[model samples]
Structure formats: structure tokens, C-alpha cells
Target chain A: MIDLVSDPWPLVYVGITLGVTALLAYVAKLLIWGMMRQSNPQITIAAQRLGVSIVWLVGGVVAVQELGVSIDVLLLVIGLLGVATIVALRQPLENFGAKYFADVYTPFKLGDTVRVGEHEGRVIEINAMSTVLLSKGDALVSLPNSAFLRQPVVNLTPQAWKEVVVPITLPGTMDLAAFENTMHRAIARMRVRLDRRYPPIFTVKSRTAQSTDLLLTVMVRRPEDRDPVLAEVNLRLTEAMEKAPASASRAASGASAVDPGH
Target chain B: MHSVDSRWGHDAGTAAEPREEDRDLFSDPEAATLATTAVPAEGRMNAVSVLINTQTPLLQFPRAPRGRHAMWEVESNFSRLVEGEDYRFSPGGVSRMVYPLARRMLTEGVWSDVHWVSLNSHGPEMVRLPGGITLHNVTIQPEHLGGYGKAKEAIWSTVHGLNSPRSSRDLFWTDDYGEYTYYNRVTAELIRELDLAHDFDLFYIHDFQQLPIGQMLGTIKPKLFRWHIPFDSRKIPAQWRPLISTYLNSYDVVVVSSERYRGALRRFGHRGPVRRMYPCIDPAEYKRAGPDDIGAVTTKFGIGPNDTVVLVVARMDPAKAQDRVIGAVARLLPRFPRLRLVLVGNGSFTSASSGLGIPKSRTWRRHLEETAASRGVHDRVVFTGHVSQSELESLYERCAFTVLPSVREGFGLVVVESWLYHKPTVVSVRAGIADLVTDGENGLLFDPDRPRALDRQMLRLLRDSGPLSRKLGEAGHQTARLCTLDAAVRDEVRLSGELGEN
Candidate 1:
């Protein structure tokens, strides 16, 4: 058997693979940290996990090459598997993507009366695959997420024009009280355009170990200002999430400092 | 007077005589219907989720900067506080009466989830109190603090019938009004968020400062508003009436402290379910002090053993009618030379720098001192300036009788305190407590507006050493039972259950 450890070419290949893998892992971690610091923790963690798995996959191939395995056939097999998986899970993936977009963009929410296509009823639920509505005639209408994109939906909720709902996802580790405080202070800056009677409200929708989902709702005084207000609110939401962890840590430290006994 | 008689005594057909315009105005069914339904069911228990709001928090800590503690972390219960040093229970009707009622409802499991949002500038963002109660604090900027103070003062003055109606219209349009609205808006927003989480059964809002919160909340949930101030329809400006009524109509039920206030609300055209609930205090909190305790308290205030202590336990404000007590004391000084007047309280949270930053207390106290000096009764007056509860009890025990001389008091809790101590009280006619007092029977009732009513009442109490004082004290104690927490808890639990049924 050849002493592969002594060979210069094999040693160089091993070093290159290990070095690149470590560098890639570090870079991926940094990106994840930045995203988690700036965006929703759920999104950041999801992206991070995906990035780490991809880096490990590529690193494994490099390591195999160092061990003198043929790479062409392996690449072909992986590509074929990827294509097959994509084709099989297309519908679920589409529905998931639609749900994500609907959370951010859809004006009508659960409990709101909405009209989409031939269906008109109070929106009872908004699930991953369909938006459920209870019709006036006691029939349940389940519309696909794709229909919301294709059809023109009219929200019949009184003062629906004034309502702006923003979806927020926070990491389980993030302190809710701190996040709420920062969000309140951030939204207060936009009080000029927002209706004084109806201030911004954040309602917790659901919670899991990975993330806590909340809906941020604000009412605008003028109909024309909705789009601008939505954009501004989104921008603030992004900023608040980014600033939250550090501010939360700072607040915690400040509290502890003020209360030494604690 | 004849018109009044004709309208009330005759039938609809007979009432319509000669005045065709009046008949036509009364004949419109739609207008009449609107008038009758204008107030709506303000008092109906609508089985709705509620949000209770007040300025003072239900729970307060003795120490400052209670940082980084969990919402449930309470180191010491209210009993641990040494009344004056560690913490002083917040004064005024809201803290004394309103909070206990809310707590009782929660304890009785009448309310689904009672969320109290308050202005605790010094406390945490949120405190999860006992019985699933959550306290939300609203913080205002220091710069806007002064403006907010001025705005609340204006509203207070207007509601108490002190400010002229002409000046009140401008109040809604001022920059201070914006800040005032900002505080209320933030509170409303908080309540809205909480409602989305807990889906509360109803919103029971208290105090005059939080009046706009009902309109701002915009929830279809049953809202019960309790106005804890003197509501005089005649005092409200004509231009301000529509706006005030708009806010009042937002509530399903509008509760006032007195029937007099209910009538005033009707005159102001608040056609809602206006109910009268007399403010109450927890009698369990008051204990009769021993003679030694009384001596210790009076000695601290430099009250000699021979001196007759006349106590007035009220915040240092012109509205409290402290000047009336001072004037009455000055008048009776020559006759009863040993009489020592001990004014108990200082400024409220609004007048404190750590709180709302209002200076009315300081100004009013200064005016009072000047009046005392000018009248040559400064030597006899003892401004104890915010005594502890124990000290207050001692003073109540040591004094001949107590007086609530407010020009317009919402309800007098001090008289109730005097009653709890089995001490006779001389109450101002303007106080809501006067409704409970039957002149010389339970407690003395005197018109605050009269120049010598308070003086004569003071003399009457001073000269009487016979069974009359003891008889009045016993009767006053009986009246005090009507305003105790035990009675209040029963009424509040019943009200909460009734609301849940609706």
C-alpha cells in the first residue's frame, strides 16, 4: 500500500479541503449572526441551518476528492436526486411560499370579512394551504393560497382601508418585554401619519421553541397613506428586530446594575 | 315653573298648548327616538371583555429602581412597608376605592382576565400582579411632561367647575392637549394589544384623565367608564359638550360617584346607562391607634397634650379647600385658643418631579401659608405635610373631629377614615360624602361656599363633650360601613358577573 500521508500532492489536497471547510463554516456562522442580529431570528436560524448543511455537503465532496474518489459520477447522482425531490414536493413548497408572502402582503386577516373569487364570507382561518372563510349562507369556502395571488380580494371589514398588519417572527431566546418596548418606541416616531385614536398593536399569534410569531397592526387616518405607512412600518419592524437583542441585553445589564441585590 | 308643571302633569295632547313650535319639536318621532337612544345602554353588562385603566398602579414597591426582576417577583407584600418610610399608599379616590373593587372582581373569578394599564413612570414596563392581573406602564418624555401636567390640570379644573367655560374650548386645541392625547393614545394602544392576546370580557375605565381612552380604544367590547370627579353639566362649555359627550357615549356604561353627577350627565346629554356607585375604601386597613400612639404622632408634629388637634388630611391643592379650613381655624382661634390645625398631605404624583412634574401643590401650599400668617393663625397651624397611615390614624384618634373642605370633592375618603376611627366628622356640602352625612346625626354637613359654616361646625364639635359627639361618631361609623371594601367587593363582584352574563 502507498503511504498517502507522505505524498505532497495528497497532503496539499487534504490541507486545502480542511482549510476551505473551516473558512466556509466561519463565514456561514458570521452571516447567520448578522442576519439574526438584524432580521427575524426564525428566518436567520432557518437560513443558517440551510447554509451549514450546504457547506458540509460541499466539504464532504472535497474530502472525498482528497481520498482519490471519482467526482463526476457523484455530482451527477446528487443533481438527479435534487431534481427528483424538487419535482415531488413542488405543491407543498409553493403553498409554504404563498403562506409566507400572504403574511406580509395580504390585507385581509382571520376574523376579517373578505371577498375572493365567487366566495364572500368572514375569514375564519388562514392556514398553510388555504384561506378558510365562513360564508353568509353557512357554507365553508376554502380558497388556495394561489387564488389569493391570482384573484382580486376585497376586504369588507369596516375601516379595513385604515388597517395595516405586519407579520413579525422573533427567536425563542429573544425577550418579549424588551422587544415590545423597542417596537413601541419605534412606532411612536411614526405617530404623525398614524391615527391618534388607533395606535400600533402587537398580538402574539403563536409560539414555538424556534420562534414566536406576532402580528403588528396599525390604523392609518388617511387611505392614501397606507402604502407609505406599510413600507415605513416594515422598515421599522426590521430595525427593531435588529436593535432588540443588543438593547435587550443592555436593558438587562442596566437593570442588574441598578439593582445590585438582584 | 308653570311650563315645568305642564310638561310633567298633563298628557302629551294636553301638554301641547299654544306653542306650535314646541309641539312640532316634540312631535318628531325620529328625533325623540334619537334623543332616548342617544346615550345607548351605557350600563348594560354585555358579557364582554374589559380593560380597566387608572393612573396609579395597584401594586407599588417600597424601593426605587426595582430593576431586572421578573414580572412576578415581589420581594415584600404591601404589609411589609412601614407606611411612611418604605412606601405611602397612593392617596385620592382612584387608589383608595377603584383598585380594591377591580381586585375583588378578579379574586371572585368574575372577570376573565383583568388588565390594568397605568402611569407608573418609575416602575417596570409590565408587572404581572396577583389573580392574572397585568399592569402596563406608560412613560412620557420629560420635555412633554410639563405640557401633560398642564393639560390634565386644565381638564381637572374644568371638571371641578373651577375653570371658566370659555377657556375650556381652547384646551382641546392646545399643544398640551396633544401630549395629553398622546398619553391616552399609548394607553389605548396597550389595551388593544392586550385584548388581542387575552380577549378580555370588558373595559372598565376610571378617572377623568383617561376619558379619551374609550374613544381611542375603538373596540366594540362593552366599555364601562367610572368618572371619579365632580361632573357639573353647568360647568362644561357648550362647545366642549359635543366632544365630551362623544367620548362618554363610547362606553356601554357610564358610572358616576353620586346621583347628583348622574343628573349632571343627563343634563350634558349623555344618554347612556349612567349608574351611581359610591367610592369605597378597605376598612380592614384602618386600625384604631392606642393613646400612646396618638401621643407619639402628635408629639412628632409638636402638638402638646393640652392642644386640641383639628386634622385635615388632604393633598395640598386649592381645589381641596384647605383655605377654608385655615380660615375657619383662624376665625375660631380667639375663642378656642389651643386648637392646632394639622394638614396631612403634600403634593400628588403629578406634582412630583419623579412623576408628572406639576407645581400646583407647591403654589397652593405657599398661598395657604401666606393666608395663615396674614390671619395671625400661623402659630396655631401645624402643616404635618404627608403623614403615614399610622400617624393619620393617631391624628384621627387624637383630634376632636375631621373636616373635608374641598370646594368640589369627588368623594371624601378621609371622612370614612374618621368614621373608621369612630371620630366625628364635619363634611363640606360640596363633598360627595355629604350625601351620606345627615347633618348632626352621622356627621356635620356645612356649605363650603358659606363664609362661616365651617367655623360654626368647628365650634359646634369643640363645645360638645356630651353624648352628642359619641352618638354622631357611632352613626358616622355606621355610614362608613356603606363605603367599606366588604360592601364594595360584593357590589363589584355582582357587577362583574352581570357584565359577563351580557
Candidate 2:
């Protein structure tokens, strides 16, 4: 209508920017994976997600700029909108972010008894918004998940320190039995650092069409060995995953993710 | 009406009417469901769907089903295949007890449907039994099966108190243990797959071989585990306590064969609902063989008519202590010159050619033969590898007495079979059934760990002065009622009903 075919360079440049951004996002994902290969897989995954998101955000801004938009004004408006949203969802955003941190960093799990500040009860549920506790008198107590991060929480369960649960996420098509067998053999090699009485056990947390989530639990002999054992088990799990055969179609429906100890 | 025996203080005789306990066990709605093809009442819960996992397959196919016989290709009805020719019911507690129980429950509509999963390497993927029960056979590579068999055998040996030196306390750390886990995981995976379709109401797992399955299964559904073997806390290694307790606690209910085992489970730190259910066999499956049947069995085994046959029906394994019975027989040979010991049974599924193919049974048999020969009693002992059910019944009828001489024994169902024939038995003190025996009243008890204890007990039966043997037999026949299928069904019905409520 307005002689749009006269100069298609802006559209072409925008398309090119998006194409390069995709390639860069993939490269960033690989770099994150390689760099944090020896670290906890959760950290690696989070970093990879963060890296790709930043690449896309920058690429999107550049693509928009190629359409003759003012970058300074667009970014100012975007920043203000993001700030306003965060302010509006401050409580929920805090709780949601805290839940992610608590999942990886908290000492207690769903079944463990814990004391946070003046509150103490058996944890019955860990939901998106709040952690529910069943009191000894049969009363239900709901606490904000963000409280777990702010307060010094003490796990009251016996030998809670000995437990180290590592979370895992795998492709739905991975051979779970073979992966489990490989993990067992790998964990067995570190028996000296582990409590011989309790072997490594994997529990399925959830499953989906694309991925399975699992939690791998191991008991350490000494409290000091918890962090090291967690790191080493994560490393071993990654190695096992790398070597895992691509087919466990039988158990694909029961794939799972992992989390640290209760 | 059923007569209550004063000595036992329980109904020892069968009646045409359901017993009082049976009425209480199966409610009116359940009885109504069993009586006719009718649905349960409005308030009553529907019949439950059960997923049963056991180590023993219900039927053993000589080879894997293929082509037209493949499970996916057919309706999976196994009635067309002639049993014993195309397949055979596995010779153990599974076929003897579990199969009949499933059939009875199905007929009664106690269960809506049942899917039984077992490790049967050479069998079809699935087979539908007569009563609409689906059998899911789980197969693994032979090499993996070999490792799994070794680990299971080691656990068996440990639990039975065989105490082999090579049986390390750190068995969970071994590579063979990985294979054991692999098998359980595969079975659990299969069960999970089935649960998706059937949405089972309960999962009942049998024996120690599948103990880890309760923990491996992610479902929050009710799980019941039956520990079939001897479960002595002292016999279990200290290193195995935590893992064993963890696996055991994962179940909603844990059932053992004896009160002693229940106590032991408690002592072993199993903090769960523990119920003691005595292992049972269907008495209807056994028949009192006639004189002609006994004669045929005697002739086949070359046993003389004058011979005082002492029968021992158990698989040839070191734990069974068949050699101990041979030693006792050797000691009593001079006293009773015509004494012939008949050891009937070959190997368990683990030792079978189509199974894991472990040669423990064969090795144990050869050792037993050598032991008999060394004691100058080779010809006196008849080693009938394995016999048909009819042959076993005939031998039971022909025997003067049966002896269960084991270092450690689970509830000895063979002793119950011996009691069925009204044949006095000398049961090991370590057996779970020993709790039911009153020394001189129903059955004789012997400490297999003590030297000459079994011989002394056997001598008591051989040298019965008056009505000692007959009185013991009559009393034992009463005790046998406590271990029959009817009694088991009552207990099982109550247990499953309680599970439904919770």
C-alpha cells in the first residue's frame, strides 16, 4: 500500500539479527554447560537458562531497533514496566523466588520437623505460595516460603545432616534403568565416604511429556561430607547421564527430577 | 456346624456354613458379591484392582511365546496349552498358595482385576489365567539374571542362617546388587505402566527378593509386602539394618509368616503396620492316596514294602539341611534296619534350567549323595529329584513320618502336608510353625543345631509304645486346620478390607 517493497533492508536486518541471536543463544547454552560441567547440575541448568534469556533480551531489543524505534525510550519504558510489575507482585515474586532457593538450599523436606523463628511443626506440604505444617495438636500452620530464606531454620529430624538428596532432570526418552544402574555403580565407588548402611536411592518427583525429574538420595557418614558428597554425586550423575543409552521407553512415563536432602 | 476342639480352642473341623470369623471377615455386602454376580451395595466400595509382584511366575513356559502365541498377537488365554506338556505351574508357594488365592478372590469378586508381575525369562510377555487374572512376565538378559540370582541366593543363604563365608555383610555395595536393583526397577516400571491403564487400588509384593519395590514405586497407593522367609533380627547383618528398615517402612503394611518374625521385624526397626499371617496351602489340592497309589510310588523308588519310609519334601539346598536328615537316618539305620529316607524335590526356580540356572541345587544334591555314600547309607536313601503332585501325595501316604530338619525354616507348609496324611512329623524348632507345636501333643520338635536331637525325636516316633503316634496324628490333623487355604482367605480378606478403609 505504501510501496513497502521499495526498501526491505530494515526487515532483512531484523530477520538477520534474530537468526544470529538464536545461534548465539545455543552457543551460550553450550558454554554454560561446559563451564559448569563439574558443578551441581541445577546450577548449570539455571546458568544456561539465564544466559539464553539475556541473549534473547538483547537480540529482541536490537531487532526492535532495526524497525526505526528509539532504543533509549523503549528501554526506559521496559525498565519502568518491569519495576512496576515487581513492585506490584513483590510478595508473590519473593515467595516464588524463595521457593526455588529453598528447594535447592533448605535442610528440611516435606516429612521433616523444623523450627523457624517461633513456629515449629512437621512439614506436610511445600506448595508454590506457602509451606504447610501439621502441628502436634493437629492444627494446620501455613508459612510463607520466603520465611525459609530469611530465618535460621533448624531441622529437628534425627540424622538430618547425614542425608544429601540431589535433584536430576533428564530427557523423557532416556533409559532410566540403565541410568540408574550406571549411577549405582558410580555411587558404589564412593562407598568410603558414604554411610554403608544406607545405599543411594532415587525417588521420582515428577514426570512430563518432554522430561522426567528425579531425586537421588545418599547418606553420608559424617556431617562434613555432605557438601562434597553432594557435589561428587552430582558429577557422577552427570557422567552417568552422558553415557546413558537413549531408550528406556518402558519407563519413560515415570521419569523424575531430584532435590537435596530432608 | 464346625466342632471346636478343646485342646486347640479353635474350630478344627470344617462345616458347610461359613464360620463365625469368616462371616465377620467378609461382610454381608462382600458375601452378597461372592454369592452371585451382583455389584456391591451403594455405600460399599467397589472391588479393588490389585497389582501383585512376586519372584515366582505362576506358570513356567519351556520357551518364550512367539508369533501367534505372542501376548500382543493373541487374547492371552493359556487354557489352550495343556499344563505339564506346554507349561507347568511353578512348584513352590506361588503356585501352591498365591495362584489358588487369586483365583478364589477373583471368583468372589473381592478384586475387580489382578495383574501379576514376575521375573520369568522364558515365558510369554503376558498370560491370562482361567479366572481372568493377567500374568505379566518380566524378562532380563541371562547375564543379568545370573547376577540377580546370585545376589538373591546370597540373601536367601544369609536369612536362612547358612552363613557362607563368601556372603559378605556389605552385599548392597556389590555389582550383583546392581543387577538385583535393576530387576526390581524393571518390574516396578512395568507395574507403573500397568497402573496407568488399570489404576490399581493396591499393590501386594511378595518375598524379600522384591523388598525394594515398595520404595521404588512412586505411587502413594496402598502397598502390602509379605516377607515369606525366616526373618530373625539377629541373623540380619548390622550393615543392612537401615536400608532394610527403609524399604520395609515404605509399605503401608508389612506381613510376615509368624509372630516371631513380626517381633523380629519390630526389633529390626520396621516402624510400620505389621501383621502375622501363617503361610498356608490348599488342603483340597492334596489327596489321601489309596493303597495302589502308595504301591506304585514304592515300586518306582525301589522302596521295600517292609521299609519304614521317612519322607523329606524340600528343595535340595544347603539351607534345607537335607544332609542333616541323612545323618539322622544313618544313625537310626542299625535300630530300624529297613529304614529308607525319601528326599523328594529337585531345585527351586532360581536353580531351574529355564530360570536363573544356578547349579546350587545340583551341587547340594551331589554333596548329599556323597555324604550318604560316605556314611554307608547310599542305597538306603532315595533321591527322587522331583515328582508330580500325585507322586508326592502317594509318597506322603506311604511314609510313616516326615522330618523337617533345617537350620532355619520358614513356616513349614510341608509339615502341614505331612499332617494332612495324619503322619507324625518332627519339625525343626527354628521353623515358624514350631510355635503351633506342643512337644508331645501334636508334633515333635527338634533343635537341628544340637547333635543327635533330630535322631532322638525320630526315635520317639519310631518307638511309639501305645497311641503316641496315632494321638499325635489326630491332634496334628486338628492343627493343620489353622494353616489351610480357608484360614488364609479369612485373614487376607480382613487385611485387604482394613486397607480399603485407610
Q: Across residues A80-179, which tens digit of lDDT does each residue of candidate 2 receive?
A: 9999999999999999988877877788888999998888899999988899988888889999999999999999999999988777888877877778
Cα lDDT for residue B417, candidate 2: 87
Model 1 has an lDDT value of 0.71
DockQ, all candidates in order: 0.03, 0.33
Candidate with top lDDT is 2
- Tens digits of lDDT, candidate 1, B1-502: 0121121224354634533312321234543453333222333333234467887665443445344344323223322333334334466548656665665554444445566777766555555444455555555556555766788899889878788877775565456665676577656656655665667777888888888778767677778888888888888777566568868888888887787888888887878778788788765345556777787887788898889888899999888988888898988888888999989899887786556767889999999999999999998888888776667777888888888899899888888888876789889888877888998899898988888988888888899885778988888877876776656655555565555567
Candidate 2: which stretches are off by over 4 Å?
A1-19, A60-81, A134-139, A247-262, B1-45, B65-75, B164-167
- Which candidate wins on DockQ? 2
lDDT of 2 at A43: 67
The CAPRI classification for model 2 reads as acceptable
Residue B333 of model 1 has an lDDT of 83
Runs of candidate 1 with Cα error greater than 4 angstroms are A1-262, B1-50, B59-88
